[model samples]
Target: MPYIASFDIGTTNAKGVLVTHEAKSILEKSVPITTIQTEHTAEQNPDQWLDAVLKITKEWLSVGIRAKDIAAITFSGQMQDCIPVTAEGEPVRPAILYSDARAGKQAERIKDELGTALIREKTGNHMDGTLTFPKIIWLQEQEPVTYEQTASFLISAKDYVIGKLTGRLVTDPTSAATTGVMNLEKRTWQTDWLERYGIAADKMPEICPADEVVGQVTEQAAKKTGFAPGTPVLCGIGDAGAATIGAGVSQQGEMYAYIGTTGWIAIPTKEVTYAGEGVFHLTHPEPGMHIAIAPLMNAGNAYKWAMSVFGTNTKMSDKFAFQEMEEQMQASDRRTSNLLFLPYLNGERCPVQNPDATACFIGIKATTKREEMCIAVLEGVAMGMKQVMELISDASDYKRITLIGGGSKSKVWNQIIADMLGLEVLVPEESQYLPSMGAAALGFINLGWDSDYQAFSQRLTAAQTFERYIPDPAMSEHYEHKYRRYIKLYPALEPLFETSLDSE
Candidate 1:
C-alpha cells in the first residue's frame, strides 16, 4: 500500500505521521523542538526542525517501511515565524517565533504609518508584533549586519524545512497571510505595502497554492533524511488551516476550535469577511476559501500552569495529573461559582489585542479553595473561547463546532466549552492527529490519490468517529451571566497592567 508522510512542525514538538492511501494513520512519531525564550523573545533554530524530521524518518525507516512506499510528503506548521536565510538556504540566525514581542515598537510604527483600515483591507489582519514584517524590521534596525546578509525571509516552521529539502524558498498563501505581507484577496505579496514599510521585496519568498507541487526532495535532503530522491513535496498550509480540514470543517460556515498551547475559533468562509480589529482573516488550504480566526495566547498553557501549582505533590504522577484536575473540576457545582479567572496569563491576541494584559482571579475570598481555582481556570478559558466564537458569529452563523488539539482530551473542559457557547460540540477520536491528517489529505489530492478536496473531506468526515456534547440549558444560562462579568475584568485591569509595564 502506498503511504504519505505528513509533518506537523508545532511550537513544542515536531510530529510525523505515516498514513495509508485509505487515510488510516499507521504509525506516528515525534521529537521535541526547544524554544529559546527570554523576557520578551522566543526563538528556535531552523536546523533543529530539520533534525527532528530526520530523527523521525530514520526511526520509521528502521522499522521496515520502505522509502519508496512513501508517495509524497506534505506539511502543516506553526505560523508567523520569521526565519532569515542566505541565498543557499542557510539560516542567518535562530528564527523569531510568533510569541516574540521584541518587535512591538516596530509593529506600532508600521501600524501608525500604514493605518489600520489599509492594513486590514490589504492583509486581512491587524498589525501585531507576532508577524513577519515587524520581525524583519526589528532585524533591520537592531542587527543591520544580519539583515544586510539575509537573502530571503521565510514564514511558518515548515517553510524552512521545505527550503532545505527542495532547495526552493516558497510559502503557501495560508502561511504568507500571517506575515502581514500577503494580499488576502489576491493571495500574493503586497508589493506596495512592502515599499511603504521600507521592506525589500526580494526578502519575501514566492507564494504558492497549498497543494501545488513546488519541488522535489533533492539528493542532499534524501541522504540526510531517509526519503527517496525526487519524492514530490507539496507546498503545505498553516497548522490552523490544516487542523480545520482535518476536523472536517471544509464548507462555508463550518467551524472548529483548536486548543493547543494557544487556542482559536476558526470558521471557513467563501467570501472575505472582516470582523473588526483583533480578529484574523486568513487563506484556507482549499482554493478560494478563507478562514476567519480569533486566536488566544493562552489555553492549554493555563491548564498547565494550574497543574504545576496544584499537582506538585511527590505522589502526583504526570499521568494522573489530568484525572485529578478533572475530578477537582467536577467536584464544584456546574452552574455557579463565585470565583472568576481572566486567562490572559501570557497576554492575549483575539477580542483584546493587549500584550501587557495579566491574568487575575477575581472574587477570591478567604473561603476559596485550590480546587475552585482550577475550576475557575477551565471556566476562564471556556469564556475566552466563547468570546472568539461570538466574534466569528458576528461575521457568520455557525451552530456546530468541532474541537481539536490537546485541550479536547478533557471531557470537563469540553463540557465547559459547550455550556459556555451554548452550542453542540463534537470531539473526534484521535483528535490530536487532526493537523497531520489534514496535511496527509492535501498530499493525497496532490498525488491524484483523491479527486478533489471536497470529495476527500466528505469521505474523511463520514469515516470519522465522534463524541458529541450537548449544552445544558441551565448551565448555559449561568455561563451567560458570568460571561458578562468576565468581559468587564480586562477593562478594569487595563490601567493597572499599563502602569506596571510603564514602570518596568
Candidate 2:
C-alpha cells in the first residue's frame, strides 16, 4: 500500500505522521521548535522549522518506512503565520506566529485606512493583529530591508516545508484567507488588498486548492528527508482546516471543537460566510467550503498550568492527576461553587477578541482548597467555551459537535465541555491522528484511491462512542449564574490589567 506522509508544522512543535491509503498509521514522530519572545512579539525561526522537519522525517525513515512507497506528501500547519521567502526560496526572516500580537498598531492603522466593512467583505476575516496582512505591514515598517528583499509570502508551516521540498511556492485558499490577501468572491489572491498594505503583488504565492499538485520533491530534499525524489507534493491546508476534514466536518452546520495548546470552535459551511462581528470566517482547506470560527488561547494550556502549578508531582499522570482532583471536587460538593475563572492566560481570541486580556480567579473564599481551585480552573476553561457557544448558537443552532485534540482524551474534560455547552459531543475513532488522517485523505483523493470525499470520509472516520454527559440541571444553573457574573469581571478589571502593564 502506498503511504502518504503528513507534516503538521505546529506552533511549539513539528509532527510527521505516515499513513497508508486505508488511513492506517505507519510511523510518527515529533520535534520541538522554539518560540522566541519579546515584550510584545512571539516569533519562530523558519530555519528551526526546516530543521525540525528534517529531524522528524529522518526519525521516521529510520523505522523502515522507505522513500519510494511514499506516494505523496502534504502538510497541516499553524494558521495565520506568514513565511516570506526570497525569489530563490530562502526564508527572509523568522515567521510571525499566530499568537503574536505585536501588529496591533498596524491592524488599527489598516482598519482606519480601509474601513472594517470593506476589509471584512473583501477578506472574510476580522481586522485583527492575528492576520498576515497587518503583520506584513508591521514587517514593512520595522524591517524595510527584509520586506524589500522578499519574493513571496506563504501562510503556513507546511507551505514553507513544501517550498523546501519542491522549490515551488504556492498557498492554498484557506491559508491565503487568513493572510487577509485572498479575494473571498473571486477565490484568488487579491492584488488590491496587498497593494493597500503597500505589499507588492509579486510577493504573493499562486493561490491553489488544497489538493492541487504543486510540484515534486527535489533531489536535495528527497535525499535529506528520505521522501522519493519524484513524489508528488500536494498543496496542503492550515492545521485546523485539515483536522476538520480529518474529523469529517463537512457540509453545513457540522461543528468541531479542537483543544490542544489553544482551543477553537469551528462550523463548516457551504455558502461563503462571515462571522459578522465576534468571529472569523475563513475558507476551509477543501475547495469551495468555509468555516465560522472562534479560537481561544488558553484551554489545554490552562489545564497544563494548573497541573504544573498545583499538581506538579503528578503532572505526567494526567488521568491520575485529574482523577484525584475530580474526587476532591465530588467530596467537597463542587466547592469551587461560586468561584469563576477567566481563561485568558495568554489573552483571548474568538468571541472576546482582546489580546491584553488577563486570566483571573474570582469569588475565592477563605476556605477554598488547592484542589477545589484547580477544579475551578478546569471549569473556567469550559465556561470560556460556553461563552463562545452562546455567541455561535445565537447565529446557528448546531445540534451535535465533534471534539478533537488533547482535551478529547480526558473523559472529565469531554463531559465538562458537553455539560457546559449543553450539546452532544462526538469524538472521532482515530481521535489522536485526525490531522494526519485528514492529510492522508487529501493524498488519497488526489491519488485516485477514492472516488468521492463522502465515501472516503465514511470509511476513513468513525465516531468513537463518546461518554455523553447531559448538563447537570443544578450545575448548569450554577454556571449560568456564575457566567453572567464572570462576564462582568473582565470588563471591571480591564482598566486595572491595562494600568498595571504601564507600571512595568
Question: Which predicted model would earn the best lDDT?
Answer: 1
Steric clash count of candidate 2: 0
Cα lDDT of model 1 by residue, 1-504, tens digit: 688899999998898999887788867887988999886788999999899999999999999999999889999999999999999999999999998878888989988988988888888888888899889989998999889889999998999999999999999998898998789989989998778767789889999888988899999999889799999998998998889889888887677899998889888887665665778888987677888888989998899889888764636775688788888777778665768999998888888888778899999888888888888898999999988778777522656789999889989899988888888999998888889999888887887888877777787777789999998999989898998999999988888888864576
- Per-residue C-alpha lDDT of model 2 across residues 1-504, encoded as one tens digit per residue: 578888877776677788875666656777877788775678888887778878877887787777888888888888788777897789898888888988889998888888888888787777888789888888899998989888987788888888888998888777777876677766787777677667888888888878878999999988877778989999988887777777777777677888887878877766544533656667765557677777788878898788777773664586687666556655655624787888888888756777878888887888877777777887888887877766554523776688887667766677666666767778765465677667777787798887756666676764333444555666666666777887787779878767664597
Which predicted model would earn the best TM-score? 1
- Evaluated at residue 446, the lDDT of candidate 1 is 83
Cα lDDT of model 1 overall? 0.87
lDDT of 2 at 392: 55
Per-model TM against the reference: 0.96, 0.93
Candidate 2 versus the native: TM-score? 0.93
What lDDT is reached at residue 498 by model 2? 71
